[model samples]
Target: MNLTPADTEVTGKPASRAKRPAKSAPGAATSAANAAPTTTPPVTSSPLATPTLTAGVASVTHLTEKLAEYMSPSDLKKVKEAYRFSDEMHLGQVRKSGEPYISHPIAVAEICSDWKLDAQAIMAALLHDVMEDQDVKKDELIERFGAPVAHLVDGLSKLEKIEFQSQIEAQAENFRKMLLAMASDVRVILIKLADRLHNMRTLDVMAPAKKRRIASETMEVYVPIAHRLGLNNIYRELQDLSFAHLYPLRYHVLAKAVKAARGNRREVVKKILEAVKNTLAMAEIDAEVYGREKTLYGIYKKMRSKHLTFSQVLDVYGFRVVVDSFPNCYVALGTLHSLYKPMPGKFKDYIAIRKLNGYQSLHTTLIGPYGTPVEFQIRTQEMHRTAESGVAAHWLYKTGDTNMSDLQQRTHSWLQSLLDIQQQTGDSAEFLEHVKVDLYPDSVYVFTPKSKIISLPRGATPIDFAYAIHTGIGDHTVSVTINGEAAQLRSELRNGDIVEIVTDPASRPSPSWLSFVRTGKARSAIRHHLRTINLPESIVLGRQLLTQALAAAHLEPDLPETLIERLLNESSAKSLDELYADIGIGKRMAALVARHIYGLMGGESAAMPVDHANAAELDPVTICGSEGVSVQLAQCCLPIPGDQIIGQLRRDQGLLVHTLDCTVAKRQKQKEPDRWIPVKWGSDINRRFDSRIKLLINNEKGILARVAAEIGESDANIVFVGMDEDAEHVLHQLRFTIQVKDRVHLAGLLRNVRRVAGVNRVLRERS
Candidate 1:
């Protein structure tokens, strides 16, 4: 992983040519021919002398020594210059621990150097805190270092100058800024992660509340990000540190327990190790085996989630076998299995199907030494490197190997997705929400019809799958099939299922998809599409609602231009469409706005107060069941045509139509009577409506199929079906949400279902 001279070609002047001024004898004539040039500053202290420390903070001399191993002389010179400048900028600043603030940046840069990051990244790391803490400007850094370094420094800086409504909002906006920068250049997040790791390491000096807050934030955001980027070494350390700070007692208790377990199991571990080594030696396989210990957080999480005791967590101690080649990984796995009994359904081959983060290993569990389960992971040396370093291996190895390139590509793809989500999302809080949704580490690998592997979050539906394939496909997805059989779009996909999506140009996303989708891409795409179509539809609906309200006062539907202008001005609307949209979306009451418009027109009845008793005499608003988002059918009662329905004007949700007899609607009416509007079904209704029904049937073979067939024969499409068995009565209670044309269509479907053989009773379900 060390860099050669060719890899150290940084953008700057040659080291020898760019030299610092040397001290001369007092009043001596300067001669250009005799002048001495050097890249490093003249040493005031002897190299063998005791090191100088400020508040227990070491000097940058150590950093330069480490850089000398892989960095070119010129790049090394630039890094020392950066360190000196940063040290000067943070002169009197001190940390909470009373250490010189320069120590923090030095520690962060050392972490980056450990990763073999280029000289430019090292310089950026040293200066990352200056812009945020010292108010240093980016242009100054550009003049001092270069544009690339300056950009990285700027990316690390927070938006502290701007005031936000809340601290969470401020944090979210800052993260949003940093993420967008990371999408452009991956080094931003890499440096930022190093910075966060150092802070977490030294977080004990902070107040209790601040410690918990920072620890929780690190666990929620940075920890997942580290895991996503495949930084296993850093990821594990961060998890342990966060666990230690967030739950000090639990972390210490688990740590102690693990320590004791190690002593008690030492003999068993030794026996298994010898057996595996002897078996592999006989098989003539070359491998390096090492024991792996689980992190404290991992143990605590396992105990809490799976309800296991410390001893029940058998895989806490495991082994990793690093081989010389990919084929040897499986050879070692087989060799080890020969020495012990392999556990069924406890093996996973990640090499054939790599994780989304580009992690590859062959994992298995074996019964070792007195029936104890031991976990083993087999991988090649290169795979091991990639697993530990992840995308950072691209720079560390600099070999352009297939594995390294694939890891880089996968990371870039994920970062690019964040940018796409940012473009679709406008609010910082909402963008952060979407990012959190995407950050979940657990993923399931499924397949496209063409055998292409597509990885999605666990519990992700076909909607998420469609969007993962393409935004256009997701927008136009009409149906899908799982494993060559028709399946609901909301079905939870399983591993290895072949998902085939059917799209139509006329098909569009439904708002209900937001309830089941697990990916942010699908959610954002649906919202963007809905917003695009909502405005125009809302304007039209608002006009109809206002016109109906105006008719109650004996006014014309089309008002004079002067009166319209006055109404727009009085309503604080920039345009007539804005005014109507507000009314359509229920932001303003149509009746009050109509009365206000009447007064603008000098109508005598405009002075009359609104009469609630006469509300029934007004013209009714007509809904055709296809009024887009501006008009919606309430899901509580699932109102359809021929059902006596009333409209409830909900702010920002537009008009919700519900059955007049719905108990939920009655409760709402008692609280907010003025929000209720008289509505009627239009003659041109053409779409199907969902109605729920409950059925009790005799428990017998093929009874469910018989009832479903009866509903299908009546031309009703079943959207969802749920069943519960009554063992005491030997009957089954089945609930179905089916789509039909109207109340009449639903009645016919119910009648068919009731006539099916073995049917005990059928009734419409209302809330």
Candidate 2:
């Protein structure tokens, strides 16, 4: 807890240690008194006193009393067993604050109880750290508690014991494990979130640097994950606590500003509540209304992000109106909107289109009598309960309600997509990359031709939706229909729009699609499908051709696959399966793989040259001439229409393309540039290429988003966006490396970029 003035005096510590630096003169000649040096101590000179072992027993008793209100007799007995086990395991352990470690587990358990989670989660919370901190074994936990409870404990335990290269990596890996468990059993993440919240609340006891790192990691990883999982109560509290420690100055200032604003707007809030109550009552909509305060973190975020002052923050106060049913929620929205003039475009109907996290509400920002914008959220009593407790509401509303037929049908789509993503992504880092991109909350709900609604992230194009529905649909999608009219597949979908996909069965998956698709599931599926259909052919043909080509240099294709697998695995390819898949789609250089394979197998076939005479026999081609034979820029690397190039003839890799100046190519050339032959774009060559370019512009309001929309309008596809590097002066650079038809199309796109409102300049990159 942060100290108050009275608390500071009672604790016998200064408000800030820096205020009394213990030294008088800076450079004065030293006498006996002046010669005494000074030291800077911590702000908190002492820790909170430890709870006694007797108090530990009383605390468990207190917890048992709390549990009595929520658990059954059998569950209560299980809880007692867990408490006893944790208390015994942590018998001699103590926290840095000198408190019995048992207190930590008790506190964590109390937090889980607040979420009203299951008995297993509560028990797991009480023993989360026992396996890591003590010598307790998993078998002991399983024997004492049930296997389910033990699994939760083990999942939590790994997060503490695992060593990672960096704190961020460790947090990411832990979060990944927690999410995987949540996917199988939702309670694990719920318990983990509770543990994180309690940790953040008491983070002040640690050193300042450690506090900042912990707070930052919590804010970036756990809070977002919790929000994604719909744990709103924990999400809000964690975000606020992290903000308090991560940016103490900003937190205090924002808190003071919000407090002052609330003091001034108390009458306004009261009047609005009265007006809303009267309006609802007249409509015969029975409801319970409560005021809402903007968290300090929310305010601080707005001030720094929107560049607004406290006075300019309009939606600082609001109301959460809970009614009896979904119909009554709409009734209340109608009544409220009728009484107040809603700010233009400030209404959001999340009730019909709930967020990915299962959040549902009808939100509107209205201008009151004084022109101040006050936001109001209307929901059913069920939604209110779920809004506060989130996934835990599954237990609260129906304890034994395992028949989640409705929810399963709705949620299974996303869950199955996760499995698909994991399958397609060869490694954890790539999976995480794709998952983080999808976790962002800006989403739109569009409908299928059959009128089924699908929620996708905002800026998600019809192509993304197509892939979301089915990989085959996306792979073969030629066009789309939006509300019964022909629409481009790249067109952004909006709420309530009906969409239909037009596909061609003969069409193949384009490597360029990876740039546009948003969800991890879609990307994974596309890659998986492409590999399954194409890798075997490429590998067989590549091996045959490479075997013959390597024979010219006295090498064999009979080498063990282990050497090649080890090399590629480090780059995230699992086996020859992934390597061949990438080679088949022009995503990976076959020669690079082959050369590495040969090197590992102790062969000196690095000098083999492309066989122009047999190039056509090995792979079908549109161009064949002695000048360059059928060289094409690898769409994966987008070796531009006018650039130096090299050809690596793989065993089965038809022809691998690379920039002559590519580092990989340079290294290969050092050994053998004869293996790297010159190639050029054919005159009639027509294909899309991803030529990336960076633009630095003043960070004007809505500039970056507007630029993205403009690129979308140009029929060009932006593959990714690096986060803004700086936020101070609207001076942020966006690196938009997108796919365009050819050199002419790329030129046109660059010209369009130059015309964007905030774009300072645009240039085609040389590197």
Candidate 3:
């Protein structure tokens, strides 16, 4: 579809038409074009021969007829004039479909016309490929037609001169370019979608590799774009076409099975249809019931994803019933359920809570004749139209320009979001990534404390919801309550859940939130916050490590920032902040650098009396005993808050502050002395920490549970419980990782476990 559109690769000059004079010549819309005399349209739009692919004239005349239905005489002539000009420009070229290349754009225009686009849009579709395929300039187009049409074509054309590393990169770059253009003018996307649709219709004529590449890109980008725009008609077509090209064998197999099913189920379907028709009439329900089959791609997806064959896909046959009013939908649903047994959990009332794309219907599956599952959708006529067309319905169902409808309003929100995401994510690749994440969300709709519906992508956590509500709420999200019960921030939301995000004024976004957040908004906010906030925190940690190392070398830790700068002047880094950042991010070692700086200061090679006045600067880290991500007790040492701790600054690995004199800490200190830093207990130690302990207990009935209960009595939670097998049957060593406040709490838990009937010995694990 794009290849014929000049996609910026084809150069050309103006093919003149009766319009504005050439303003910006070659390169301004600068491309080569075959200039022509200006005699654009006969002020009247006489109905031309309807354009059918198999029409009398397979030339532009065929396309002329298709436009005859919608366009006025004057508009039709203008379209024909643009077509003739484009034809002359692409005189000898042809598409991979082996048709005159001009035929492609004409077909694209026809598609746009079917969507009820304006004269300018149809004309833009006609000339879209001219700049890329032929030697046509933007100025020439502007001169021949109007600026609006030219702008639309320019937006559709691919930037061709820049070389991409691979076909995929070029495709991504092309999409990025096109998306920005579409964001400025919504019509650009409609035309581009038409262009892509036409291209896909003729894609089978291309090579296998090219076909798959185009089809895959279509699946990932265009299909989702159509869906996001609520262009369900186009979305389905693109999906089916892409499925055919991407997985031909699967599509063929599924198509054959569906065909066979239709033949086999004809009689049964007829009987059920009649029964439903009669039931509706008797109940005074006015409705139109029609039998429908799922698309090949839909069936194939179910097969692949759900691991089911064609036979097992129960709801392959479906029915859509359109009624008079919203209330009638429920009436019809009740009537259908009374007529047949409804399958449990197969009913979804989207009418009450519409899908994010604005689809609404009451869906129910029932056991039809022969035990086959028959799915039914009940909606009003307007809902039916909106359901099928999505955002496009508002435009397609109208003649002239209409007021902005609800569908358009939501779409505008999505469009503006692209610009917002682009601002937050500067890299084009990253921008694409963020956009893609939002594009294809399989949503889970939840509720607020006020019972307001909040729909988010499936697998999205409460943290994502907090961020979605507002950055302030997200920053201060201290706790969550799902249905009035306390839950963690990482809790995955289910449908119908009433989630409450409890905020504390002092709390901030944690680095750990990034691990479970599923939405682009939360991911971006957390990343932005981390990049800005972590630098200072890491710098402080680096300085602390440096100070402790300097103290260990019997040197004064009172050096000011300026003093440290002079000491590190010989290094490439210019300032203390730079050196601190380097040390914090693992680029340099604190102890080695500190010792080197001490040597440069020309310190005496002797010990000095120290009052340790700077003990306030080297302070202990405050941590809750709970597994709060960043802070952790070293498993080898099981250091409690009261223990004298030595911290190791493992870059990106977080800190594993260990108790002094622990065997593992001693080895790590010896191997990487620079990594060892000073640490102590903070006054406000809250939450529990897991400590491994060995409990030798006699193997007895329910003995393990008894020991666990005893540990639980000590207010300790069982983190892990495993038996050391291959020991005597009567006596066994149980290895447990139990959560406790500290060594003192563990001591209390050990006594409790030792009191259990089968207990022999309870000792803290050290090896």
For all predicted structures, in order, the TM-scores are: 0.76, 0.68, 0.67
Q: Which 10-residue span in candidate 1 carries the lowest summed lDDT?
A: 1-10
Global lDDT of model 3: 0.70
What overall lDDT goes with each candidate model?
0.78, 0.65, 0.70
Best by lDDT: 1
Q: What is the C-alpha lDDT profile of model 2 across 238-257, one tens digit per residue?
A: 77888888888987777777
lDDT of 1 at 222: 82
In Å, residue 435's CA in model 1 sits off its true spot by 1.6
Q: Measured by TM-score, how close is model 2 to the native structure? A: 0.68
Top model by TM-score, which number?
Answer: 1
Q: What order do you get sorting by lDDT, best first? A: 1, 3, 2
- Count of clashes in candidate 3: 41
Name the candidate, 1 or 3, with the larger lDDT value: 1
Deviation of model 3 at 488, angstroms: 0.9
Lowest lDDT sum, 10 consecutive residues, model 2, at 40-49
Per-residue lDDT of model 1, residues 1-767, tens digit only: 11111100111112232222232432231122113221122111111111222344435655667789999999998997787777666655556665665676777787788778898899999898777656678898999999999988887777867766466666678788888888887888888887777676667667787677677777888888888988887888778887888898988788789889989988888887888888888888988887877777888899999999998998888998988888889889888888888999999999999988889999999998889999999999889988988888774222234554777877877887998898876456777878888887899999998999999999999999999989999999999999999999999999999999999999988866877999988887776676556879878878888887777666788888888877776565788887787777676788888778777777654584555566587768888988877788888999989999999987545789999999999999999887888899999988898999999989889989999999989999999999998769698899999999998888888888888899999999998
